[model samples]
Target: MFTKEKEFFSILFEAVSEGVIVVNTQQNIVATNQSAENMFGYNKKELETAPLIQLIPKNYHHNHHTYVNGFMKKNESRQMGVGRDLFGIKKNGDIFPVEVGLNPFTVRGETFVMALVVDITLRKQHQDQIQELNAKLEQKVIERTKELSEAVNKLKEVNAELDDENKKRLKAENKAKEALKKEKELNELKTKFLSLVSHEFKTPLSGILTSAMLLSKYKLEEQQQRRDKHIKTITDKVHYLNNILNDFLSIEKLERGKIQYNPSQFKISKVVNEVIYNANMMLKDGQIINYPENIDNYSIYQDEKIVELALSNLVYNAIKYSSENTVIDIKIKQNLDSTTFIVEDNGIGIPEKDQKNIFKRYYRAENALLTQGTGIGLNIVKSHLENLKGNIYFNSKENQGTTFWFSLPNKYQTKL
Candidate 1:
């Protein structure tokens, strides 16, 4: 029974990607999964029967023991190393940073604690480097002691060099900041995705489920047509679900740096036609897409798929935000060195304050808070256009309308 129980739980325990270590009431490491073993550079055999303190830094041992005893006496579990930093010692005696979460459990009248450990060395290093850079920049200004007139004249060049250095340092720091910012964006994306899926997908999936269930009750020939209607609804809802999944998949590809530009020569009209064709299914009653004239004869050398995506998103946004019977205008124009696409709509324009964050992933304006959207469409559009060496901007008035315009370089290039 003991072996069976262990085997049953081993799957779940190992399934956790983070390192997990189990320690007895005496703080002796009793068992550890592969992640824990690998993280600390210690095997299961080596970890078993070893004092837990061996894994922690020597300087923290006293406080660690006191905290453990207090936790034991309380018979409750709380987060370990809260309000302060924590360090872990690897098998090779090299100390590294870690974040630990502790939970206490009892089995067979004996109490044991489980620790979930995450190695945060990279996070710590980035933090330290940013701090060091900031400190150096501050020290440079504080150490200047010459008179103001002479210093301003003589040190102007040095200050300019320092300014350049500061910019380089800031650029490097922004990389780290981008990582953290992306993490926050992803977390917020999950929330928005869940909300969207719950509200948007649920309705369609519920329709599919309901239609499938209702179809079984029909047996006569007269009911066959009704059953066919339900089947069509199911099929269309399934297709909608596929599109939702595709959007999420695109986000995953973007995050993983797997989206490569595969630009090819294609006619601009082809992109607009495909976008409008696919988007026609989603149009509201009396809604119309006004296609620009003379577009079909135009040619451009760019990624047709990307242009289709951006145009589709903008058109959909126009439709979703505008009331029934509104016209969405699409205009394509070519200048001396670039081709521009404009999507204009008489919809509820974005608020001025929200314009700055319109391209931020999962950011929705106050006026659009209750609107049915994932808030990732513009972000994806902007990202794709930027990758294709294009620029996007918009002009909007709160009650009037919005005109989104973007231009791509007019370069003849074959597929990469």
Candidate 2:
């Protein structure tokens, strides 16, 4: 019965998943189960007289000996699984991972240690592979985070650059605006200076021209006749200079707010006739003036001097620019609300691009450059019209000629 019980216990030990190794107090292996033999790749007979260290990895064997000695000194049951990296050696001397449980037993007054070991190689291998995969995943996360940070930094840099560019552009635009304003002021000053110079020179020039022209017609000796002819040439030059000066002076007075208006009831036709007579003196040879006969009886209320000056400027400009022998038409149309004066001439018309600026002080068209002018005639006319609470407009085409029309409100008669 005891032999049968022994055989049953041995079979049970061999059936266990753990490898069972029994060692005496001297640390030599005395018995081992079939599982132990298989775990270490040893036969049952070969395990006899083997030291426990023989199955341990060489690096761990020394520390294991110290632990076993401590256990023997204490004479207490001590566990081996805690705080250790367990290892076992195969019959071929290959070391692998293991888990060990040690238990002590006293049999017949002799102490023995029973070590239950489990092969943990496959579990450890799976754990290592999992760790490697986790490490790779962590590395990828770090790389992605770095890339995102770089992209955000780049966007911030670009935004800062754009803001700087916008500020620069705004500064440039402000500078350009300031420059344009300065240019405009300079232009106004130039116009004022030219006007002043022309005014100061006109009166003496007109006197010299009139005197020379009168002297030219006198009966004189041969030497005197030659002198008279020279004087006449000077007269012509002075007359031309006087006209330019007059235009400038008129523009200056208008721009300087020095022109005064004395409004009164007057015959509009008389003013028109007087302007036509004055303009005839400057007309080119063979130029004719045509006036509307019906205007003789029309009356208007306005500043007579200012209106006459305005009409004279327009009529003179028309005759000066028209072709010789071309007929200029002057017409008057009176309505219940206003009076319209139309001056039409067969003159070289203003270019389309220059027409808008024609009334601007000192602005001259490209085609009108050869025509002697101070570039102030239309500006004077515009100023006079504006002062009278009237307005002027014109139409022209290149080479086709021009017509100017202005209207004064009849209500001014009561207002004045």
Per-model TM values vs. the true structure: 0.54, 0.49
Off by over 4 Å in 2: 1-182, 185-220, 223-229, 232-246, 411-416
RMSD of model 2, in Å?
14.9
The prediction achieving the highest TM-score against the true structure is: 1
For all candidates, what are the clash counts? 0, 0
> Per-residue alpha-carbon lDDT of model 1 for 1-416, expressed as tens digits?
13656785578679989899888889888778899899999987899889999999788887888888888878766777889889999989999999988888888888988899999999999999999998987776566543565678768979999999999999999988999998998788788778877887888889999999999999899998999999999998898788778887887787787887766888888888888997788899999999888877678777778878888888889988988898999999997788999999999999999999999877888899877666778888887777777889999999788999988887743222
Q: Give the TM-score of candidate 1.
A: 0.54
Expressed as tens digits, the lDDT of each residue in 1-416 for candidate 2 is: 12545676588777888999988877898788888999999997898788888888778766877888777667666557588677788989988888887788776677888888888899999999999999999999999999999999999999999999999999999999999998997888687656645653554566676766667576557568667666866766776677766676776776687776777888888888788777777788999999777876789777888778777777888887888989999888988989888889989989999988999766779997766566777787777777777899999998989999988886563212
Q: Which ten-residue region of model 1 has the weakest summed lDDT?
A: 140-149
